[model samples]
Target: MELSQNKRVADMNYFELIAWLGIGSSHPGGFPATKQNLAVLQILPDEYVLDAGCGSGLTACYLAKTIGCKVMGIDINSQMIEKARTRAEKEGVSHLVEFNIANVYDLPFPDNKFDIVIGESITVFLDKVKVYREFFRVLKPEGRIADLEMALLKELPVNLRHQMEDCFGAGTNPLSFEEWHNCLAEAGFQDVEIKNPQALKDNGNIVMNELKKDWVLIKDLTNKIKRQPTLLPRLQKNAGFMKRNRSYFGFGLIYGRKPTPVKLGFKDWVRQVIFRKKTNSSK
Candidate 1:
């Protein structure tokens, strides 16, 4: 199908947007808590961190309060950034964290400023190539990026795949392993580690135990959407193309670092998921 205008987070409610955006992140460990989500990515108390596509900044704020470290969070939507900042301040982490309204491709910082960068299911919403290059430019050498984003295992059943393909359109990006590697390599990240953070892990059952109610709701909704199919996409406000490919998509995850002294698991593949970053320099 043809790609046109990009989709916005407001295409749906904040919570629902986050839900759809975080594919394959079954939160094995409960939503944010279930997967330990960003929490699993430990932080150093004195290091400076950048959080790209910080959404509500829950992870950013938590990073600051938990580590007492300096963190700068940025996102394209001004309103979301504002809400994130307010929450940070209310939680008393504002002293160590700052939120900004900006796009991932045009970060406002000097090169090599952040010790670590994170995108908690945020990269799926950005232009992967340009954003990865930007991250390479702004991060401190050897800095790591962690994210829980949707990855591709393989194509789902055609009907499901096509339905998803239509509903998401260009908004949905599915990448093979090789494609992901080339992109990261071209962007200058070495020792890249791209594997299923939850691969074959039965943690989904544990997660389902918690979100069971939501699971039932989503399943019922899923079946309901399949029947009409167009209904959910329309309700989600997806345009024509997105609605056309609603079911043609699936998800998984990725993580990597800037040129670091580590093992190289190099390979050629198409990539879909991404993790974004920010720095100490204020916008």
Candidate 2:
């Protein structure tokens, strides 16, 4: 899958291509897994949810329809936000879901604003620690955060690792299964559960099937190429890379609970002050 001579993979990132393609459920397990995660969330109709990287807003609409809850979706990509807004309108859940162009690192909402936060394969493309911290800050006490993210089954060779990182785009440095757990723990999440790790090597077939169901997949992709002809070659190159290095990558679904704030009793406060004094003395 050689790209045209004039275009390089560096010219366009993989996420831009996905945004242009307008693919829904653009993760490893697709929508089925998305539905499963939503089901287990046990959402109450009265609760408010955040879809952190709601690409096309499919999950947002689904959440609204399934639980009749309010869903606010935020994405950094303006183009994706526009498409997501249109999808929400089309699904007749525009009133139930709001789409905004916003960064995950600094969410526009105030602290403790949401009952639940959900993301699908989004954390892999950001500063995971910072983004998780933001997710933690915005969630109410005992609120849950759930995500489906890419994970490396094993370490790749140095050259292969560099190549994959460069080509995968949007900071797509996937963590190992254990690393993800530690990341969540460090971000102030307790009871972290990383589960259902699946091999991504043969998952291209799943992605293709989902895209095939979209009658306008080619149409949207062609429109993207017309707008920026150089993107075609870069997209082809990404495809080639994925086909070649699929074996090293996989996906994981994660869930974590934000601990409820506890009131400190006299003994607990004394212990904390002593601990703080000892920490400062050591420093």
* Candidate that would win on lDDT: 2
Give per-model TM-scores: 0.62, 0.84
lDDT of 2: 0.79
In candidate 2, what are the lDDT values of residues 19-116, reduced to their tens digit? Answer: 65666676877888788777777899999999998887888888998889999999877777877888778778888999998889989999999998
How well does candidate 2 match the true structure in TM-score terms?
0.84
Candidate 1: 10-residue stretch with minimal lDDT: 268-277
Worst 10 residues of 2 by lDDT: 1-10
Tens digit of lDDT per residue, candidate 1, span 162-273? 5544544445565555566666667777777654444323232322333244322344445444544444445444333323443332333356788744543433111211
| RMSD values, in order shown | 12.2, 4.4
How many Å off is the CA of 275 in candidate 1?
A: 36
What's the TM for model 1?
A: 0.62
RMSD of 1: 12.2
